[model samples]
Target: MSKGLREYAIVDIETTGGSAERSRITEIAIAIHNGVEEIERWESLVNPQQPIPPAIFGLTGISDDMVSDAPLFSEIADTIYALLKDRIFVAHNVNFDYSFIKHQLGEAGWQWQAPKLCTVRLARKIKPGLPSYSLGRLCDVLNIRVQYRHRAGGDVTATVALFNLLLAADSEMVFSQMLRKNGVVQRLPANLSQNTFDNLPVTAGVYYFHDRSGKVIYIGKAINIKKRVAGHFSGHNIQAKRQGFLQEIYDISYERCGTELMALLLECLEINRLWPKYNRALKRVEPRFGLVSYTGMDGYQHLSLTKLLKHQTCIQSFYSLREGAAVFRKMISDLGLDIRFCHFPLEVRLPQTANDLVRRIQDLPDQELYNGKVAAAVELAKADTSSYFIVDRGRDEQEKSCIWIENGKFYGMGYIPSESQSNSWADYKSELQRHHGNEYMMQLIESFLAKSNSRHQVITIDAEQLDEAAILKPVELRMKML
Candidate 1:
């Protein structure tokens, strides 16, 4: 190849398995092209030095017996590096091949880096709107015959032909633009389209990544949808799971939220509802400890710290045993109740006078007085569970967003118009979308409310106010100013 002439090395390899870190190449083929025609070609079978899995042998038809006498990658690394040193690397799903070769080369003491062009992405740009872009399906659609289907040599030949077609049909100079160092197109996954990425909105929203079968694989919340999605593809991570995740993403869809808080709430709800494969953070989360009330044989209502139990109501739920114990200790201290009746986790530290208190419990005669104090404490603990609305900025200027907490549980959230004239809570409830709430959702709301600088306003309402005609009068006036 002469200087100043654009050259590409169309390459293909048959590997032992899908992961580059865990698999090795068994066969390789390369076709060198200088803009218009092939200048050189090379093909070889490599002794991977590892047993090929039966599945890979079935796919490529290259068994251990066939590669017994072949050259190891170390023996041919120099030749392979020389041929691809300064040329653009082209392949179907380029990253998969690139990662395998790059990892092997580094192991052989040759660090290599080159520009890559994925024919799958190029075809999508050049041809526009093909139903499927898998090598076999695409060739069948275009009437380009592929022989020796999964073998390296035959796949390289078919790829060369595909590259030629893409070059000829690329009237918009997309190839040249993608070759630029700063182009995002070069970093995107082969199955994802530039148009789909470009269409992501720069606003707070919940985004979904769908696989080829249109099943949601991941769900996330973002303050800026475009920037956050772009971050997922920005790194050069070669882990098998990360690589597989990138390849699985074939489409993206998003739902815009009025505020970051609303986006977070929606993300939690959808993740729980859909149980997407890539969502692991919130799925396993729940309150770990609870403060429950039990009636002992002595006819006294007792307060105790216990592990979260199903089918039993808790006076308060906490994320940690220490937190629950601290609250329980304070309630006992404030109500002047005997500590002997209260059960605590083994890790909890009791006060210095606990032994004396336990001895005195056997002599106590008035159970009614102690029961009254326990009941009063329980009522105080439930006082925080008031029905309220968290009002915040809406998606636009025409409305405001409201998150409803019914009797201290998240009911739902939605946007209400600035000029609404509804008078009762029933009318407001009809405007909101309902969602199932969990302990994690309550924790999020509580944390947000605890923030001293939070801009959202809280509107507390009692059961009696739900039927009043003037319940929303003040809230309506507040919405207009928002």
Candidate 2:
């Protein structure tokens, strides 16, 4: 080994499952290289102390029977640690292998941390424009051969060869640049470019991560676009979905917003529109159950819990059937309404007094009076449905952002010049961009308004104001009124 030459521990491991936290390593291989030639080669089959799933056994051809007599990872922990210590951990999709070893080593009472080099990322950087970067495809492209496909020993051999090729082709010293301490380029997705990340603004915005074919895979909103994007790649989460997501990120695009509220709104809209694969949180935020009213054949008004139906209005919405039922039962109890007139789903366990109330249908109030009470409760629930506008800072100092809520729903939002004299809500509506609103968007606005320190100002607009062209006071005056 020559002085000043970087050392690498080329590694590969077969695991019982995809998650490092849940899975155990079944086999491991390490090839010690002094940035020139292999100094040592080591391999082992380990008793993972768990049954190997059939799928994994079939893939690696290493069944539980084979590892039954093998040594546990604890027995070889010291040797593995010594081999990897002070060497750059190199592997195909390196984080997956590194996470497993690092976790299992910790379980064995050894804390190990090392710089890592991913051959897949190196090939994309040094040998650009390859159709695929998977180990098998790369071998086929580079004329490298392997005796066993999924086994650690065989995969590590091919990875070493690929690393050598990348080293020879890396005339731009991408390796050195990536290895620098706290380099953002090293943490970025293998397919994403440094320039794309470098160009990200520190302002509030929504960002989109697209795959190689330009299909959006994920969408997120951040106060600082670059900082938040970096967070996605910061942790070594060896979960299969996260690993796969990082690999698919090939490009990034962003839309800057004046406020975090605007970024959040845009994020929700885009996630719903694009239906990106990695966006699961916002999509599931919509309420699933609603409280509805209908007239019975007996000339009585009835309230029921029903699944949210498109084009049908609800007195109130809830995320779960139980939640909607709870509120419905409270309303009925408070109004002293007949339990028989309210429809409860089969899943709901009625209160102990429900049977007693059902027998009191003969004692029910007059039809007109009972219906009037129901109508009053409906009106109370609808009180928060009034139209309003939220005014805040815009993308730049010269403008201000306006969010219009019509009849208690998010109508749209847009920026207006700071000096614009238009004060009519009707004029503001024409200037803003229209968007379909959902329960989640409404929740965001409601939560924002509830914050006592919020800088935004709210202006209430009545239906009569829309008809009469009523003028809205300036935002500063509105703040004073609040």
Candidate 3:
């Protein structure tokens, strides 16, 4: 061994459990070597901020009481990152140690990455046909003594010796093949080539992860496509689901949506269309429930959370039950709607209603505004009688984006030159190229209408004042649509 040999951070970490996503690291130790000799050492008892299970307590002897005063991983993240920054990360089970550190550093707003060297793999190739490769057993076979077996300081100290021996013993090319892969490769599915990975675009857009047969397995949106896609393979804290996802990805593809808003819209559409293997796999935390309104036998329109008939249209749908309840509570306060008439479930009921329950459910200021303006936008689109306008900010400032709905169907989204911003509706439509829009676009627009309260929003146009209709204002660029 000499000074010219590459530096390695021979590392070990003990954790509350296996998965980096769900579990926490309790201890870490690093023994840095210049591929020649151990240069320095660092160790920490990390406060995992989680309850250590009784079994883990017995196994590592790292108790909650012992770690009560220790600094959290966040506190020591900078020091750990500096040590492992440029050197290859060496570990007995490199994936486990590397991934735990990577995820912990990520939580602390740092990126952890390095080339990997698994001493376990190295030992098997160097020694050949060992009876047992476990660190304790292997050290015993080779006459190397290790203290403090389950603790990071002891295990990493043991690994440093094991690593040097294997490097000295590598008479064949096994170690060179192992060195061919960088840390990122360890998480990439075997079927994807480094060349394909290098070719990913760095623009803001939507990306698709595909299986070997070319079927989409996952869909994602990112402001920087390359960085985000690179992150998908950043760690190997391989949970079963994540491992399966990696095994399935054969290639990657993407669509460059010039605007983040467009990218967001497209991501929602693609997820709804493909419903890929990995996307939306977790149960939704926010409620996807809604309340619908119908006219009952008493001639009063009733609102209820239960599923209703086809003709019973929804007043509003919310992302969470709590959001729906808030809106209902506001309705009772403003519209003087009765608590019983609110028709919400028991969990949503307020303990005490406003003493004066005035049932003025009709002709409210909001109701009048929606009826006059918002309803006009829908009716204009629905009647398909005349050209309607939905103007939006373009991909960039030099142009503007517009949506035209003819006959209550998505006509297309097209661009207008900023120079011609004041062009009439007919002129704008004349320059519009025929483009594709889908069911998602319709819903996207519907949602927009529910949320908006702009004055210049054009539901229908005056035949003579066409030029004014085309200039999309910055204020009108927002969507309050439902």
Candidate 4:
């Protein structure tokens, strides 16, 4: 347990193949060391109980016939434990040997875990800019003599020598920091230091990835910052660009949003503001095409899907021309508006000219009905006061999160207690934690309200029960669960 003397066990194992999940170890060697000097050494051949592929035999030079009569790992598991028990396990690519030993030990009735160091990672820091960090290439570059190339005893002895050299060169304790986070966390982006990982918050927020030149290259929103950021680098199917992205990332910055809704809205707004290279949405600056109502010279109200003209009022905006067409088509069908007047391309006999179409539209009863529908839709879409709440999953069974709004302004968001007397704004506000809300927060409220009908629970509070004074005084939250 004592690291004062820098005691470690340099371990190397020749496995049947590349994966610990599918391959079994064929040979093992260990050299216990106290930083600069080797203390004890051990080596053994093991019964892998599996056919050694010809490719592996060619690469490692360990034939199946050699280990045919060798004892199964169960026979020597006790001896392996004695060697690695408290010593920091060290290897060229430590995870390879560490994982093999750890897994094999678990099946041999021993739980094995130890502080680990990878000399590959260490050599990169001590003598960097090497073209490759593979054990063979690295040892050759450093001029460390490898007695035997693929054999366990020879490779582990070379690892021991490399470890001692790294120990002498490590002035910053990089090896110690490498072992700080246990398990597969070592898969983190190599350039991301432990200090950066330690500072990540476990809260809802928007995180930005900045490249070496301090330009934000990517931005993301997450409910748990650490897990989400770690996930970006943890997977096995890492693409070339993904690897480059990790290497290019020089710094990370984050803003904690008090609620997930705020986090989502802020992510959307920041993506639009920055237009980061990785962002796809909200990058276009042009206003979307919309269905607008304008009175023509013939005094007929016409619904046109196009860039709104000066003094024209928009009925609704659509991100794509197709969406606008669909809504316009539905409007024309619902009100029985003539396609010839709306300028829709048709195969049948069409109005000869624009003026003639306007005259036909103005002369029809359909224009009046269309105008009335537009008026009613506009009124229904207006967000005055008392019709908004941002509801998301609760922290626990007895809780629910709600962000309250009134008169199109944010009141605040907080946990809703299961036992409630009234659903008044004041009652909800008393339980709510207030925030310095912004335009994005208001937009989030509106968007959630529009989408809640199908995807979310629409909890309708009795508006008549909430008197004008109730918005201000003693709280009682009553609700009609819808």
Candidate 5:
């Protein structure tokens, strides 16, 4: 067994929200297991000082009232710090729980650092075919018992059981082999995890995609920026393509715009200004579409595909004029548009010699004017924006509540009013704006809240039910099977 499972400290925490830097931990639990057997256990309630947002209270089931009388984090920092020091910070989703602790400790004047092992990630490497490895799901598969669901002690206990199962399933040597085989993906990108993603305020913003070398490769905008980036790293085929690029990415920098429109506008501006080489799909300097205008004896002002750089707008995008013409002919047959005006015009308006035809063409569509949906999609596909809502189940007897989202980041949170001067969605949109987010943020919020699928909301709506981190869960089962 590689290094004999070295002193394991399985930990878990219930937090106010996603960000470690901003969100305070309301509860914490840890289980220390020496190589041969389990050794020690500890847990505590931490006073965050700030009022627990209603949504957070609903999610973790630990309310402001429960923790308001507890010791502040400062009071327990040293004790907790000493417990975690030098042990492998093990957790179901180590990145999420550990980050909050580290950030809190740092604020307490301690530079906390430790190696981490994620049971979620470990199970992924060891047992690749399971539908889900959430602590609850794993316990069901292995029949482990967990009592206090969302409470810190309950989660840590479950994580401890899950880790023991992992050890039993694969010897320490096997884990080492996998770790070595995976070739040093041990620490996640320094700030990419809970530090950056969880804490990211859901807001409309422009985010820059960078290589490990700290170079900007792509720029994007989103209503929830955090979700967007998480989607990129969500272990799909695309994530494999991104691994090399993302591994080189050590930092993610962002600018929060008050609205999504501004983010989009700024994204366009940044892409043009930076022209990051990786964004070649958008930056490629070839005109793929053209405009074809038919001017004939019985001319019915028709515009279709063209080849001479002076024709009507074409449907298919291509690298050269030849390809453009070929695509135009295909689109005519594909969409079943009028082919007579597109491919074979009986009477030609070409210069008998050449100069006359060129001069007569006034409304002939220019190549530059071919900025249709194809161009727009091409440009948009290069953007790196991801979005999702930060849903906190309502503490009061009300329907679930959601804050606006943008680019997988938190934009703002608030309750929608009953009598707003707008349509159903438009009212919530105005609420997002009223909360300091603008149209772009509202649009992002609207997109998520409007969806019929149940996958978008990450937190359990009841606030009483405990759940598992869905990160690294098979994308198919990550959200409800949508």
Candidate 6:
């Protein structure tokens, strides 16, 4: 934290994947700056002890062949530690790159530590109302040349340039903001600006957003409202129209809770009672269907769908019945599920063509274009039923969960835990039997259980209750059974 990038250690790392706890670093770069002057630069290739997925190789151009003979992080541990220690760790998405490297260093028996700063967060504060703050996007907007897009060295250098631009754009405000002992109190989306939310306690709490008319437009709860609400206003998801609308409001309010569980309970109570229009997460007052069950010759079998009724443990609430159904179909196809028993007409096969997908996309509100162009985008999105899997970490070191999703919807989810004798898929099947018949619970379970990466068996909760101990307890109990 200096007036002009003081002794900054702007850093970046190309990694095998996203999670530091699970993935490995493939490359690293550090650019040291004294004020605005570059003091030195360093870069290296690292042996990740894992195969570089072909997709990542294609993205970063750092392949297994390229890194096979590179120095393992252990060999360069001392050098990296010395290079970064006491220097401000800076990057585009600083935490991501920093965490990956720090985790790697720790595994190599070196505890890497450094104060961190993110260009993405800074750019949002300085250059608001942009289409994107991604390092590449920002570079393009600012006309800053980056020779390597995904490579560590290329990205670090670009981040330094971007960070410099942000500083130049608003030197007084940005620098003054940084001077605080605590992190900067960033400009919240219009409604929350009157209050310095940064000083808002990190304890569990429910935060409220009020429209200019004094109507409660949204209510949200988080373990750290300071962090979570900041995310909503951070301008990360630019395409979210609702966020823009919320930004237009002029007042904010909040209530604190002793624990995240209490915050969650309060949030559920307030959202149901207040019925805010802008609170997307809790706007609707209904359960979403997950699966449809019926009696069969063998026994009761559950079929996944999106239609939901009351009295079941609903997982995710949807905007409409159509949206819910779309989520269900996406999940069903992702899990390679059959359509016959789920109550739909037997011939309602997964749409495999542009026309079929177009019809489906026609149902959701158009997100991409003007007027009638939604028909076109749906045609494009539905052309493929790309299958994907969610890998979740389990309760113990050796255990993990695999949640399969297809086409951006919930599908069947399975659990994986440590212990050679336990079968996670089997445990999931049993849980499905007990909870599957309930429509709301089924979709909730499917969506919550679904995972894109198998890093560790992580608990599934709403974005708001991500840190609630009460909510996590059931998840842990279920994991214990497996």
Against the true structure, whose lDDT is highest? Answer: 1
Model 5 TM-score on a 0 to 1 scale: 0.42
lDDT of 5 by residue, 231-329 (tens): 655432222233345544545778776445446545655676789756665454444345544345643334443433533344333344544454455
Clash pairs detected, candidate 1 = none
Give the local distance difference test score of model 2: 0.84
For lDDT, candidate 2 versus 3, the one ahead is 2
lDDT of each: 0.85, 0.84, 0.70, 0.69, 0.58, 0.59
Q: Please, what's the RMSD in Å of model 1? A: 4.4
Clashes of each: 0, 0, 11, 6, 40, 18
Candidate 4 residue pairs in backbone clash: 385-407, 422-476, 422-477, 422-478, 423-477, 423-478
> What's the TM-score of each model vs. the native?
0.83, 0.80, 0.48, 0.48, 0.42, 0.46
- The C-alpha stretches of model 2 lying farther than 4 A from their native spots are 1-3, 288-314, 318-374, 383-385, 421-424, 452-454, 470-482
lDDT per residue (tens digit) for residues 39-137 in model 3: 999999999999999999898999999899999999999999999999888887566777778888998999767888777667765786777667899
lDDT of 6 at 394: 35
| Candidate 4 ranges beyond 4 A from true positions | 1-6, 175-221, 227-482
216-314: candidate 2 lDDT, tens digit per residue: 989999999989999999976878778778878989999999989999899999999999998988777867888888899888888888888765678
Compared with the true structure, what per-residue lDDT tens digits does model 4 show for residues 329-436? Answer: 766556556554464323323323433455443457665775676566445434345644655556555766676665556766667865556635666768886655
Ranking by lDDT: 1, 2, 3, 4, 6, 5
lDDT of 1 by residue, 249-309 (tens): 9999999988888998999999988999989878888788988888999798888889987
lDDT of 6 by residue, 86-107 (tens): 7777776555666577767787
Candidate No. with top TM-score: 1
